[model samples]
Target: MVVERRSLIIDEREAASWIRDGMTIAIGGFINSSHPMAIVRQIIRRGVRDLTVIGPASGGLDLDLLIGAGCVRKLVTAYMGGEHYCPVAPMFRAAVERGELQVWECDEGMYYCALRAAAQRLPFTPWKAGIGTSFPDVNPEIKVFTDPIKGEPLLAVPAIRPDIALIYAAHADPYGNVQHIGTGFGDRALWRAADRTIVQVERIIPNEEVRKNPLATSLYGVDAIVRAPYGSHPFAAPGYYIEDAAHLREYVAAATAYAKHGDRGPFEAYLRKYVLEPETHADYLEVIGIKRLISLHEY
Candidate 1:
């Protein structure tokens, strides 16, 4: 029998307990966009090591935070970028440069492979992407071949079923129905393709409110819900404005300074503020007030 619809609202500690060592996790976010930074902070606090993190475009404060805290072991991303000069996801470049992190840089259709493979509960999804690009350089084994069901040139991608898919929403009902006004691509697919899904909502409301709109948040396939305030920031997605300019400017300067010279002190300082000191992303925001963040940077 199917379970009754209910949202599992949890504290950071309880929500973090859901994470285990060596689990393949997925984070939802874009360049300085709507990522589940709050939950990510707690995951970092737990210090779970040797985890594989996957996402579409994760170059943001969240990526650097996790990589700097040393929580990420492997990363699978379509791409990453920052609002400033260079990419924010230090994990990708650091891994390639330091030879410690394993990365799988997939192509566009690989997304099709990842989403479909997980959603279908299949071993893998075959496709025609990354045939002549750098993708094979990362995943040498994954390739295009004949489909077992049909004779055709097909590439197979291993099921990208994430142990946990952490996402953020502008609003959520008490029942865990989430509404995202903009850019919903792959949002629902990520959760439906994972073993468990956790949502951090900006506002909490009743099911009646959702029913008021035909485009309200959908209620199926949610496992957990968390109510948070201003969850987006240097991590806010497109629909939201940028969170902090001063910090972002500092980060860009730091990365560029490192590139120009051999000093990583400034970048490390930035890391200290967002990664080491704060227990949660919310705390980090408190450290840098919303108004100040705006004053310091631009969207």
Candidate 2:
């Protein structure tokens, strides 16, 4: 008997359908790089609601966009901010301040360990990442236990097995094998920990080409793959492009106004112009203008 592999190529809309209301979603990225912004836009367009969003460390626009769109009911992350420049994520801060969003704050190291536990199919993992801090007090769900072997105190964080994982990469093949160029981040762990992994890439090449460089093919256990050029727009993709600082600044200003004034006007206008108006990612690229996007690309 011979085994056959199925192609996992899918469109952004179809990728959004894989996520349902109230499902736990893990997005791959650090603060401002390699985020699956295209899929996040699609999910907003689909009007998916009541989602539990998970970010590895701190997420920038990707998490803020979802929060602003009212798609996230709960956020599980180590930190939520605009890295160093933008200070705070306006939408996220607004929601939290208004008691509209629930947050499960985990230490960055503990968050990674929890995902690793999920990937290994374990119930929980023991580590000292959060034992000596106020995190254990604020988040009582994270328990402390005595290690049997060393007779030492350790903290246990539950495994985070998200219903779906959305990630962006530089390249992928038909069989869902993906390759990322720099700072791989927690993408690999997210891919393995989620029940379904949807990868958006800049390009889809032949499977033979993907296999040729086995080391570069760092991602596996992917369920779906979509081709989305400029997928991580406004955020850097290392060798592919630089961060769109101007656009980010614009967002920060708009979101801050909304948060401070309790007015939805500026944020709504921003959403309508950027997200709702564009029927597809291609349309978005066109709206961004070819010349402007090309200027951001790395030579």
Best by TM-score: 2
Misplaced by over 4 Å in model 1 are: 1-7, 57-61, 147-152, 238-240, 255-264, 280-282, 293-299
What lDDT score goes with residue 270 in model 1?
67
lDDT of model number 1:
0.69
Q: Write the per-residue lDDT of candidate 1 for residues 84-200, one digit (tens) a residue.
A: 546444434655577767777676468657767888988887776555665655686476677778776666777778898888777777666778757755667677788888887
lDDT, each prediction: 0.69, 0.86
The number of the candidate with the highest lDDT is 2
lDDT of 2 by residue, 27-103 (tens): 99888889888899999999999999988666777798899999999988887887764777889999999999988
The Cα error of candidate 1 at residue 236, in Å, is 2.2
Model 2 stretches with alpha carbons more than 4 Å out: 1-5
